[model samples]
Structure formats: structure tokens, C-alpha cells
Target: MNGYRKLPTAVNYQFAEDLYSVFKTFGLDLDRLSYSSQTGQMKKLIEELETPDNLQKISQLSLDADFADMKTKHEAFETIFADQAGANADLRQMTSATAIRKILEKNLKTYFNLLTVMKEVAGWELLYSDTNELVKAAKNSEIKRKDENPS
Candidate 1:
């Protein structure tokens, strides 16, 4: 958890908000098109998550199916994103973010569940604690932002 510990979830809130707006506008998940670096960022996250070392740890718990499901969802998102990125406007209109969001949300839940279960596994305490802290920080930031700019 050396370099992994340093991996930051930090992204400019304004930028993420803008990206979310665009995603809403086009009914796509984030800026899956060539218009943004977010797609690459997501891929990097998955790559980092499946690193040899991480995979080894995950294997110890026999949670490969859960991990595979998460990866499949991400891959599906990527596929839809790539298709939408190249399609004409009319073709793009046929796509909806519902499926994308569903898969991503499910993937997230799977990962969260994994982390929760992993906490009970030996050698996973620090990673689980750190990951939990990151989630709490993100939630707090969202609450603060919402409070400051009530919708």
C-alpha cells in the first residue's frame, strides 16, 4: 500500500461538476468521449485497483467473482462510451446514461462491499481504513458543497 496509499481521488469539484453536467446533457457517463480526460482517469483507477499485488491480496479471499463483475461493468461502460464518442449526433441520441449509471453504481457497490468484507481479512486493515477515510472525506465534501450552494 505504498504508492497505492498516495493515489488521490482528488479532482477539481468545479471540473467534475461541469463534467457531470455534460454527461447529463448527452446522457452519457461523465465525459466518455474524447472531450475529457476523465475516461482515462477511470481506466487508470481500474488498472491500479487490479495491480498484481492487489490481485494477489484479493485472491487470498477468493473474491475473484466480485472483482470480475466490477471489471465487466467498467468494461461495458468503456465500450458504450467509445461507441458514443464516435457516433453521429442522431446515433448518439439512441444511447442513454441509465444503463451506464446502473452498471457503474453496481460496480461501486461491489467494490464497497469488497472493501467492507476485506476489513475482516488479515493484512487488509490499513487499506480498508484508508479507503474508508477517503470515502468519508468525499461525502463530507459533497455535504459542505451542497450546504454552501443549496439547490
Candidate 2:
């Protein structure tokens, strides 16, 4: 999949600094937020800017303002991180490889049955032949393994 590429660490650092400058220019207190690193600071800043009153404050700012630039950078950063997080969560939720292979095997069997019935249909002959070749190869491999083992 052509998914989002995470921003580099240096870019994240720059985003935090730019956000700090914009907030400072607007007299927003740096002490009001609690965070350890640049990424954390950016996250906290995003959270702070999401509040109802703060949202109103930012909404009134001109598009050419530093705050506007800060918002754009923050959104880009959030989207990349969110994509990475979602991919990781999906990975964690996946079943074991053996289980996945079993499911795929079952699906392929059902698909081959359909292809067998459709072989008389136009354009399906090549597909059915190709699929049969795959099944033949797999069965031949298994037979070779059994002969070699002789147990």
C-alpha cells in the first residue's frame, strides 16, 4: 500500500519550535502545557488549540498569520502519526501465519470450485488452466516431499 511516510525527527523538532514561536507571539503561556520532548510539546499544543475558546481564538487569525502555518504543520504531523498508529494496531490484531494460511487455503478451494463451473464461460479457460497449474504444482511438491521422507 502507498501509505503515509512519517516525517523525519528533525522535521518534528522544527514543527515544535515553530508552534512554540507562534504561541509565544500570541501570548499563549508555554507553562500552561506539560510535555517532555518536542513531539510531546507539539501533541500538547494541538490538544490546547483544540479547546473551544482556543479554537475561536485561532479561527479569527488571518490565513497569512504564523498561527495558520502552525496549524498546517500540526495537521500534517498528526496525520502521519495517526496513519502509523493505525497500521501498528492492525498488525497487532492479526492472527498467526498458520491461521491466516488456513483461511487462504479454504478461500482458494472455494474459488477453484467456482472457476471449475465457469470454465465453459468465455475468457475463463485461461484462468481455470492457470489455477489448475498452481494446484498441480502444490500437490507435486507434497508428493516429492513424502517420497524423500519415506516415513
Candidate 3:
């Protein structure tokens, strides 16, 4: 897989850092994971699996501002919509089912987008783990075959 082979620790670090920065920019701490620490850990882990040469190349790519902006917007929307039950207290007092439904529909979209982003992140993590396992298995099999053939 080209994506797996080209995976660079530096790029991963920049991605994590940019994601953190975007969240901070929107005044959301997220409170799930520490970005810098996670980046450092990912760097070390990738270094163990990938070649030094490819690692250097990946580190050179700059952090993508557009991606960061999209993430920031998404987080901002999430923060606002997450407090919907509280936010719509006034609307609820008005007792209009139509208005409440509209608000809920909007909030639901934001919530769905948040879930999509989370799912993408999870998919990437799974892909990385699977790739690492496949690589290890290939290496082990090659070694075993060599032992059998005495080559």
C-alpha cells in the first residue's frame, strides 16, 4: 500500500499538532487525547515500522491549513450543537414543536459531521495497525522460509 509505505512520522506529528491547534483555535479542549504527546508516540511507533529514508521525506511536508480550517469549523459547530438541550431551553418554553424540530435537525447534522470525523480518524488508526501487522507477518514468513531452505 502506497499510503502505508509513505506514512511519515513527521507528517503524522504535523497532522496531530495541526488538529490540536485547530481545536485550540476554536476554544475547545476536546479532553480526549493530548496532541503533542500522541504525536510523539506516533513518531516513535512509525520509526520502528518504517524506513529512515521515507520518514525523512514525510517530515518535510508542511501542515495543511485547509484541512485545519475545515476541522476547526467542524469543531465549532459541534461545540454549539452539543449544548442543544440547554441552548434550546428558551425555544422549548415557546412550545412550538416545529421550531424545536428545526433546531434539532440542524444540531443533528452537526452531530453527524462530528461522528464522521471521528470515524475517519478511527479508520486511519485501524489501517495503520493492520499494515503494521501485515508487514511483521511478511517479514516473519520470509525468515521462516529462509530457515527451511537454508538460504
Best by TM-score: 1
User: Can you write out model 1's per-residue Cα lDDT over 8-28, one digit (the tens) per residue?
Assistant: 453333333433343344444
Whole-structure CA lDDT of model 2: 0.66
- Tell how far residue 7 is off in model 3, in angstroms: 7.1
- Per-residue lDDT for 1-151 in model 2, tens only? 0011123344234444444454555445544643234446666666776666555544443223665687788678668877887898998898989999999999988999999999999999999999999999999999999999997
Task: For candidate 2, give the lDDT of residue 90.
Answer: 98
TM-score (C-alpha, index-matched) for candidate 3: 0.21
Give a tens-digit lDDT track for model 3, residues 43-125.
44334323554334334433235434544664565566557746678666776888779999899668656654565584665
Q: Which runs in model 2 stand beyond 4 Å of their true positions?
A: 1-94
TM-scores, one per candidate: 0.38, 0.36, 0.21
Write down the worst ten-residue block by lDDT for model 3. 54-63
Report the Cα lDDT for residue 94, model 3. Answer: 78
Q: Rate the local accuracy (lDDT) of all candidates.
A: 0.66, 0.66, 0.52
Q: Could you tell me which 10 consecutive residues in candidate 2 have the lowest summed lDDT?
A: 1-10
